[model samples]
Target chain A: MEWETVIGLETHAQLSTRSKIFSGASTAFGAAPNTQACAVDLALPGVLPVMNRGAVERALRFGLAVGATINARSVFARKNYFYPDLPKGYQISQYELPIVAGGSLRIVIGDREKIVHLTRAHLEEDAGKSLHEDFHGMSGIDLNRAGTPLLEIVSEPEMRSAEEAVAYAKALHALVRWIDICDGNMQEGSFRCDANVSVRPLGSDKLGTRCEIKNLNSFRFLERAIDFEVRRQIEVIEDGGHIVLETRLYDPDRDETRSMRSKEEAHDYRYFPDPDLPPLVVSEAWREAVRAALPELPAAMCERFINDYGVSEYDARLLISSRDFASYFEAAAQRLIELNPAQLGNEEEARRNYGLAIAKGMSGLLAAQLNRAELDIAHAPVSAAQFAVLHARMIQEVVTSKSAREILLALWESPQTDESAIDAIIEAKGLKQVGDADELGGIVDGVLAANARQVADYRSGKEKAFNSLVGQVMKATGGKANPKLVQEILKRKLEG
Target chain B: MIPYCADNFASIERMAISLVDVKRVAHLARLEIDPAEAEQACERLRGIFGLIEAMQAVPTDGVEPMAHAQEMALRLRADQVTEADGRELFQAIAPQVEDGLYLVPKVIE
Candidate 1:
């Protein structure tokens, strides 16, 4: 029987606020284990939680970005559970009515675009950590993360494959960072994903019982966990066994999932509306305030890159993947346009092709270097103006395309504030293009004297022999000869 | 036709509380209730439920359920960093502590 995989993700994104959601304690990571925990975070008796206005505003900003419905009134409910990390027996979270409702995120699957619909996003306080090692078989608890604000974004089960699930996650990760809501740092546990995966026969209306794979921190792991779970379900069904609904943990070392707890042992949260806190009421004016503060989102910027910048869909997506890269592209493109105003004339085709050239250099060449250096566009060694200068020189035939790569490497090794520094490297390394016709013509004469058999081959209609002769000419000049001028001079002398 | 609702008081009195129910509720709340005292605890809970039953007898038709006794506006605090971290003071009260972490019986990862 054919199988189809179904996936839904729940992501907990830590808000990038200065203080915890309810208390004024610092949310900075890696503080001495419990140093950041305050009375309110530790859930000391008689302490009331004052809602952090910054946390609420960040939620509103995210709602506006995704075009979700912002509920005017939402209630905070107590989710009761017992765990060592939970200082309060009950966690305060939104249950029936969340702040944001019914939005969709666009993810690229292969070459086609697909929308992963979101069920809801709610504001909640994160629990503290349970440190299990270095204690002689006893576990330790760190309450530093106890009151950190988190936006739990839940998605509908619209993803059909592990690949689709990963794409949706990557797009959402980029967006959270782009809007400055969360750092989207998986390493520090700022952003975490839980995937609900199930498998059923193809074209079946009923979804198979799902086992949630929890706390997958990296995208590669999320995909692997889902794929492994899907295969496990198919094998179980094939062996005449029913899948048990449970909560499982993905063991990255073993590359498989193991049952953490079965449904029968799951906690009955005994949810109730908390009496201490009143129902959260958001006014129209407040939503508008947050809307005014939001930056231009990634989807809109991606469309503009395609329409205004005239690049391919793939390249446009790549350029706008990060906010910094999009800004860098705009600055470099503007510089290129200013350097040559003639390209902006009535020839619209030429203008677009010229834009494509600049796009290729920025997205392909510069992006590769940034990835190798493990630096973001914000901290790249080569400034936008310097890159623009190097690109312009290559297009103007001042430096060969091969020399441009060398200059980029040199710039990365010893960076400068000015683009004119490239001129010094070119002169010192003798990479200046020898485009003078008189100088190149003398070298062509020396090549013709050495290879008479190759010259005979070209006269007899062997086109490859002519390329060999051209290679010799470039080799004699130490690859500094202008390729276009070399081709012209070589053709002229060979014919004579 | 005989107005059976008039005898609601008698029906409330007949409602029974069992020791088993008491034990289950205590276990769910993570309390270790002794079996010897389960009967007394059950009787006390029944008294509380009896009062709720009497209140339930009151006709609440056309009345909306209220979450709180009095309607009050929620107070909002400004989003600002106002508290200095007091990590040591908080950790000092834990049962056991090592390297700023609160130690407890080991749990599976």
Candidate 2:
């Protein structure tokens, strides 16, 4: 029997709060161990925890971003667990009532769009790091990360394949960073994901016994681990064995997931409302304020990119991968329209091709130039108006593609804020395209006469020989000849 | 637990803490309860549950759960980095410290 893999993700995004979730201690990473753990974070005697307003506001922003219902009143609960990293006997988290509940995210996997429903997102404190190495038969504890605020966003088991799981994880990862809630640094462990995977017979409503795979830091690991786990579950069941519900760990080196804790060692996190913290109440004005503060979300902007700009979904996804890229594309697009709009081509093609044109420039040569200079798109030396003019010049045959790249490199090296800087560079360098029929025809005629072997070869049906003639024409004209005009004149002269 | 029913009250009263239950709870809280201590603990737990039984008799339909006695909203603190490096001061109190990290028994997962 075939099995359908069901996967759900629980992402722990460490909020970028300056202080700990409950204590007025630095939440900065790479602090000396136990240095940033204050009295409250350490859970020392005679200390009470006060929730950070910034943390709550970040959570509210996430709820608004996902279109979730922001609970007016939510309570903190203590999840009792015994671990050396947890200085407190119990972890203070939201349970019974989380701050945000019931939201959905629309993820686009290839051409398929899926709406992954969210279970809930809760506020919780992070556990400290446990370094097992470098201590003989002993473990070392670093409490600097303890008590850091994290918003644990949980999703429903709607994903079917590893590809869809990755798509959902990436969408969530992009979203958290876009909203500026979490840094989304997987390397630094600011963002982490745990997937709950199971497999049941195809077309079955009942969910199979799931094993929670923990601490998949990278998306590649998430996909590989899920694939590994799904296959393992299928094999175990097919071999007349039963699936065990337990927590598992994904080992990237081994490329497999193994049970971290057995069923007998399962934790019964006796969850009860924390007595020290009263109910958290978010007012109507506060929710509206967060909603107003939210920037144009990625999904909505992506839709706008496809609908208004007439760009393909793949190009739209590439642009919307980051806010800086999307904004740069948008600004360049508007500048294109501001320039001679007719140069953008027909109305229908303009809507579809104009954004793609800007996207190509931004992602292609401009992206490479920025990388060479170690500059991001946000800090690019070339202004959007300048880029738009460059793209517009290409459309108008003012400069060939090769000359356009040369101008782009010049502008990149020397910072130019002026919008008309592209034209200045084009004029100063004399890189104008030879669009005149007479000028191009003379160049083509000279090339045809000079290269007798290529011309004779072309006449004798060596099809590639025609390209050599075109190259000679471009070389004769100092490489500023319009390629289309050059090819048109070359074909006309050679055929006649 | 089943709802407080007059017919099931007798069975509920008989459902006192078992030795196994006490042992499990003791292990979770990281406490040692000897067999004799378990017997005494069971008697004491019965008294606590008896009082809870008395309270459960009261009908509480449509009543919201109380998280705290006071109706005050939880106060929120500003996000600021006011704490400095106090590893020496804090690590001084720990029984074992190496390179500013607390040492414990190796916990291999």
Candidate 3:
């Protein structure tokens, strides 16, 4: 029997607030245990939580970015449960009322676009970390993370496959980083996901039992966990065994999920409106201020790249992966247009090709070099201005593709930032392409004279002999001659 | 819980806080109650529920329910890091700690 997977994600993104959500405690990571946990974070008697204005502002930024409804008034609720790491005994969160509601994200997986609907995003506090290793049969707790501000983004169960789920996760991750709300650092536990996965018969409307997979920090792990969980559920149902609803933990090393707790062991949570906090009210002016502060989102920037720059959708998407890359591309493109405004209008083909070349170089060559060194666009060794000059040189037929690759490597090693640096490199290394038609035609004539048999074979209408003549001309020029121009010269001298 | 029937006031008063219910509440709260004090606890609970029952009996069909008694907005604090490290001072009061971490019974990951 065919089965369809349904998945929802509950992600906790730690907001980049300077202080704890409801305390004056520092929210800096890697602090010593209990060092940053103040009286309020420690939940001492008589200490009340004061709402962090910065946390609310960051949440508003996210809501506006997603085009979600920012509630004018939302209430904090006390989610009561007992865990050793929870010093407050109850996590203060939004229950019935959330700050942002009913947003949707457009995600592109392969050639298909899917909309991942968001249920809500609410503000909450983080629990302390529990270190279960190296304690000699005892556990250690670090409360430095206690009360850190978090935005719990809950998504509807609209995703159908692991690939689509990963795409949604990536888009959400990029959006959070683009808006500067959260760092989206999975390794530091700044952003984490809990996937609720289940499988139903292909055409059935009835939902199947789901087990919540907890704390998938990385995208790869999120995909693997969902895949394993989906297969497990389908197999159990196919073998006439019903899946038990539970909370499960994904074991990455073992490549499977294990039940953390069965339904019988689940805690009630006992949610009730927090008595200490009043309704969190946002004025219309504040929402307007936040909306004004938001940067042009990735989706909008992507459309602009395609419409204005005339690049492929894939290229536009790649350019907008990070703000740094987008800004770099814009800077280089602006410089390119400024340098060749008159000539660009003369040849429509050249203008279109120049746009494509910029996108390709920015996304392909630049991306590969950055990935090889484990560096991001922010830390790129070559500045955008310097890269723009190099690209201009290539587009003007001053450097061949082979020499351009070599020049890029040399640029990485050098600290030269001026346009003259490129000229100096071309002069010093003698890597200039020979694009003069007269000079390349002479080289082609000499090659045809030396390879008489091959030239005769070409004159007899042998197509392969023409390529041989072009190769001979390139070899005779010591690979410095432009291959495209050489092939044009070879074709003209032979065929014409 | 089912709403109090208008005609079942006597039955409602009788079952407002039963001794068994009082014992169960105490157990769930992790508090041990002496057998002799069970009736006292039940009586006090019954009085509290009796007042609540009376309040519910009053017609509130059209009254708007409020989340809190006061209609005040929550105060917002600036998002600033103002606290300094005080690990030793905080850890001094802990029951057990080692290597700057609060020690507890072993927890499985």
Candidate 4:
């Protein structure tokens, strides 16, 4: 009775280019319904869409980044469809052949890595938006988005579960942002996914009827929609009802999917090569230029982090998930190495320790402070240099790790303050660790005397009682007692 | 223009799709198709299938399947924000708009 879910994703990533793909109109978001619409976007009779060079280059950049075969020559086709939002009767898209093909995305699900093969990525123009009002019985169309550029990245049905599908989608999202081709803003419809899901008996060679779920803008919705659709299909088949192939829309509020329409085949669209535009021929030089312009992608950066920074795969993955975060870590690591040469005895250990500090301390502090301030990493008050200085101070044992964290908060509140100034504030606040063993011993002795019963229990082999004595000693010293020394002294006293 | 054999017609073997099939499909798509139109569409489809007999003569051996007429590359753009302002133009075309968004009818209960 076990059924396996098979999933494929078709993602439309709105290119981050400034202008519309074929028109000179602006591609900026949140414009008046028609203000950004140019004559071409309005589909005026005399107007013609001139391919934007920038949009083309962005597509090539994505192709190179994903290691797809950049088609030397590709053609645009007209997909004829009728909808109020479509200003023109037909939409210009790549159908018969797309720009890039046969690429693979590596995704990590749990501890295992899976490669999701990409079928193709094609360039297309976006349609206008339709508007309907409560009072108005009629609908309106906004042409601002009509000519915007989109790259539809289609994937093979290589995913088996909703988790794997989500993992693949997230990896693609990160890759797009990392390559600087797409903003990958799910909220703004900049990046969207349509999942094609089908379920068959486990290990069945025959494919089952598939349903396409549309308008999954966020990763959370992608996971939920797929999970619901899989179960729905399985139930339909179990009840002796054949699964129907159709397009469905995900209703996030209801947490269910409703049928949109029967799936349309290629013939239904009446696709034909667009006669207006000529074939797009990319020269070898052009492909090379795009390949050279690509920044270090996530995969390369992750490998480099492990090799150059000596970080673990998990830590490197976290750091390289975002380009900005990875850059921040690299900058901070560089500064720490420059400031504290004595702490890092050799080049290898220097990289290793620097990476470990960043993974454990710096990342944690950044996450906590950013969350507290409700700010993104870009708007964080603490600069990379300040973070480096704080880590250097901690490594030098001038302040304990806990004290350094407090100093970091103070620095984040006041970015203009330097490491010395933060250290002065910590000193003024009397937050420095009590490193003197003699001082810690006296505090421990007082704690033992006050909790005689607990101390006796500790002496009688109750380890929990020993921890309580250490807590009292730390409290007696106002949490300034070096915890390592406090624990050593308390254990010695109790055991003795 | 392509001819087809009557024996190769899967629809005839599966079931005779009457006016009922057309009506159901049209209803699912929210199209108001008249009964007369549905009958005409069914007749047209049956007539179209009768012509498939011509395809059996065309040898599709070394003939490569043609998905598109021509093969070409798609042009790309530099990943930069180029467009500046557009709010006013978008608002002008909206039949109805609220604040900054295009208002849509509440489709859900």
Candidate 5:
């Protein structure tokens, strides 16, 4: 019998705040270990924890963006655990009440759409790092990462495959970056995911034992880890064995997961409300203010791109994959329409005309030239207006699209050059399409005369000879001949 | 439901978890558990399990299980940088340091 895999993800996004979550300590990365730790970070006696308003505000932004319910009041709880990394015996986290709850993220895997329901997003302080190498075999603690604000977004077990799980993680990653709440840098541990995976019999309603995979910092690792865990669990159950509930670590080098420890139940932590900090309460006005401040989320932006731009779903999705890229496309489209008033005769017409131009030309330029050159849209050598001018020239049949691409690159290299300068460069380079029927006719006639046997083959119904004739004409004209017009004239001449 | 007390707990279940298991778990967690502490922990865990048995008696029909105690949403803030504390505060906690980084004992051979 086949088995079905059920997966859930717990993502930890480190809020891009300037200071640590509970104290006014710097939250910068790559600082000398312990350099960013404050008295509060060390949990020293008499140091009271003060919640960073910036941290709270970032959490609110995520809540608003995901359309999660925002709790007017939430409490911090002490999760009691003893470890070298945790200076404070108890980690300050939300238990009974979280800041956000019950939101869903939609991710597209292949042609199917999967919605992962969010269980909750809570505010927590991160633990420090322990270095085992430097202390002559003794472990040393680095408190630099301690007290960093983390928004742990937990998802319900809704994913059925590793592909869907990764898509969900990536979507959330993009969302955080889009809202500017997190840098979404997995390498620096700015964003990380924990996967809980289990396999149940194909038709079973009950879930089998699940193992929690911890510290999967990359999307590739998350996929590999889950794939390994699912197969392992299936084998274990097939051998008349049971899976032990445990926390596992994925070793990417070995491409395997090993048991970290038996999973801890909540009762093990002996959780209780933290007495040091008061309960957090927010007013309706504050929620509204945060809601109002939310930028267009990826889902809404993608839908709007399709509806307003008249672009295909695939193109719209790609265009809105990143907020920066989406804004760049919008700016280019708006400027192009503005410069050519005929294209902006109405809202619908403006969208169709500009959107088609962007989909065909601007997208290619942005992705192939600007992004490949490691330049942002603002830093691009060619502005939207200049691109519009180039596209307009192409639309008016002054230059072919092929030639326009070359002109775009030339303009991109020299932003200060005007359209006439670009046209002059094209002309000087002999890149203009040979649209002159008379000139193209002469070249076609010479090709037919030079290759009588090939021309006879075409006359006898071998149409492939026609392309060679077109190539010869284009070569003779230095690729300046309009290929479409040449093809029409050649087919008329050859067929007759 | 019987109230929790060390004296009233069942005795056979108390010894079910071997001393070796406790030591192994503690070792894996990198915790130094003395023999006396292990015995004490076993007794406490037994009593805790006795308390848990009382929960099984309460009927849960028509009751929605809650992962969290309250049904509420989290508040969020705008994505703006607003703080300027520096690394001096964290550096003070290191046992040793160099070049603004935490220094640890050498381990590689």
Candidate 6:
């Protein structure tokens, strides 16, 4: 039976602020258990919670970035629950009215863009950590993270499959980092997701019963958990069993989502507005300031790459994976044309190929080198201008693609930040390619005479023999001959 | 039907609270209540619920829910870590502590 999988993600992105959401305690990770937990963080007597301007600003920034409506007034509510980590016995969160409402995020899956509508994004305070191991019949509570600011972005049940769900999660992950709101780190519990998964019969208007899979921080785990839950739901329905509306935990080791809640233990968090803090009022002027200060989003930048560089949509998407990579590509492409206005003149097509060449290099050998060296593009020894210099040499046909790799390896080992370093390396290694047909005619003719039988085999319409003939010419030229020019010259002489 | 009503005080269908509810709520609040305490708590809560139901019958749908006594916007503070380390001083009052962590009864999921 065909089943339509439905998934909506509730992502909790920890705002990258120095202080806790409502307290003056440090929100930094990796501290002693309670060193950062101050009196306000622990909800000590006579201490009231104060709102952080940085956290509210981040929420405003996110609302603007996703094109959401920033509510003029939002309120904080207290979610009452019992946990050792929750020092105050109530977590301050937004209940009815959230800071951001009604936004859309565009996710690209296999070159098709799907807009996942966001229900709302609210600001709240995070709970502490509970370490159960090594404590005899007790859980050790670390209140260091008790009051950190978290922006919970909820999406509508618009996704149809696990792949689309993962794509949406990744796009949201990149977005929070792109807009500089959250650190987007998954390991230290920075950006995490809770997926509400269900499956209904295809083309059904009514929704199916959903089970919330909680605390999936990794992308692969999100995909797997949703898939496992979907399969389990389908199997249950097929076996004459009804789907239980409950919360589940995804066990990555076993690759299954186990039901974590029983009907008797269902949560009924008696929520009420927090009386300590007043309503948060976002003024018009403040919203406009946050909007003006917003960075260039990925989708808009992808469109810019396509329009400005004349690159395809595929290449455009690849270039804007991260902010650093996108900026580096733009700088390098623009610098390439600036460094060589005459050689790579204002011919629209030639300038366009510069973007393509840089992208190709980045996607190919340069990517491998950087990955092997374990260096991010920001810390990559090869600067954008230096990369432009290498491509400036290539676009002029001074060095072939084969020798280009050798020069790139040298640059990787010992970065040369100067403009003339490329030329110095080329000159020192004598790696210039012979693109002039007249200069390479003697070498091609000598190779053809030395390998007459192979030439005859090529004239008899054997394609492999033609390749061997080209190989001999390349061997004679010590592999410095431009492969494209060599192929063009060989085809021309063989026809003549 | 409302997922989360802004005004929690605006609605209760003369909410009937039994001794079971009192005990459950007491457990949730981490309050130890005896049988007499539970009976007294139920009677008092019933009276409060009756008064709340009278307020619930009055339709104030358009009226804004007042979260605080004051209507002023929340005061925003700068995102600075102004608090110094007082973990030892604070933990001195805890019932149990191991390696600077607050210990509680074991909670398993």
lDDT winner among the candidates?
2
lDDT of each: 0.85, 0.88, 0.85, 0.78, 0.79, 0.88
Candidate 3 residues A259-336, lDDT tens each? 998755345565767889988999999999999999999999999888777899999999999898898888877677
Docking class of 5: incorrect
lDDT of 2 by residue, A143-201 (tens): 88999999999999999999999999999998998999999999999999999999999
Q: Where is the poorest 10-residue window by lDDT in model 1 chain A?
A: A341-350
Residue range A1-496, candidate 1, lDDT tens digits? 9999999999999999989989988898888888788889889999999898888888888888888999987777788877889989889988776889989899998898898899999999999999888899899998889989999999999999999999999989998998899999999999999999999999998989999999999999999999899999999999999999899999999999999998663456756667887878899998998888888888888788788768988898888889998888878776766666334554455446556777898777888888899998899988877777777777778888778888889989998888787778888888888899999998998898899999999999999999999899989988888999999999988888
TM-score, chain A, candidate 5: 0.91
lDDT of 5 by residue, A87-157 (tens): 77789999877888788888999888877899999999999887765455666777878899999999999
The C-alpha stretches of model 6 lying farther than 4 A from their native spots are: A263-265, A341-350, A435-442, A459-463, A484-496, B1-10, B53-61
- Using alpha carbons, what is the TM-score of model 3? 0.90
- DockQ, all candidates in order: 0.37, 0.55, 0.46, 0.18, 0.16, 0.65
Residue-pair clashes per candidate: 0, 0, 0, 35, 34, 0
Tell how far residue A88 is off in model 5, in angstroms.
Answer: 1.9
Question: What would the TM-score be for candidate 5 when compared with the true structure?
Answer: 0.81
Give lDDT tens digits, candidate 2, residues B15-40. Answer: 87688888898888889879999999
Residue pairs with clashing backbones, model 6: none
Q: Model 2: how far is A71 from its true place, Å?
A: 1.2
Give the range of the ten consecutive residues with the poorest summed lDDT in model 5 chain B: B1-10
List TM-score per model, in order: 0.91, 0.92, 0.90, 0.81, 0.81, 0.93
What would the per-residue lDDT of candidate 4 be over residues A1-496, giving only the tens digit for each residue? 9998899999999988888888877888987667787667767677766787877788898888888999887777888776666667789998766889888999999889988899999999999887666435645566778989999999999999999999999999999888888999889999999999999999997878899999899999999999999989998989999988898999999999998887654226756677677678889998998888788888989998889887888888888878888888988888888886355568778877876787666458787787788886767677777778777767766566777777777777667645467567667778777888888878777778789899778777887987777778777877667777777887677767
Q: Model 6, B48-95: lDDT tens per residue?
A: 888777767787766765767787889999999899999989999999
Q: Write down the TM-score for model 1.
A: 0.91
Complex DockQ, candidate 2: 0.55
Q: Native contacts retained per candidate?
A: 0.69, 0.80, 0.69, 0.27, 0.20, 0.85
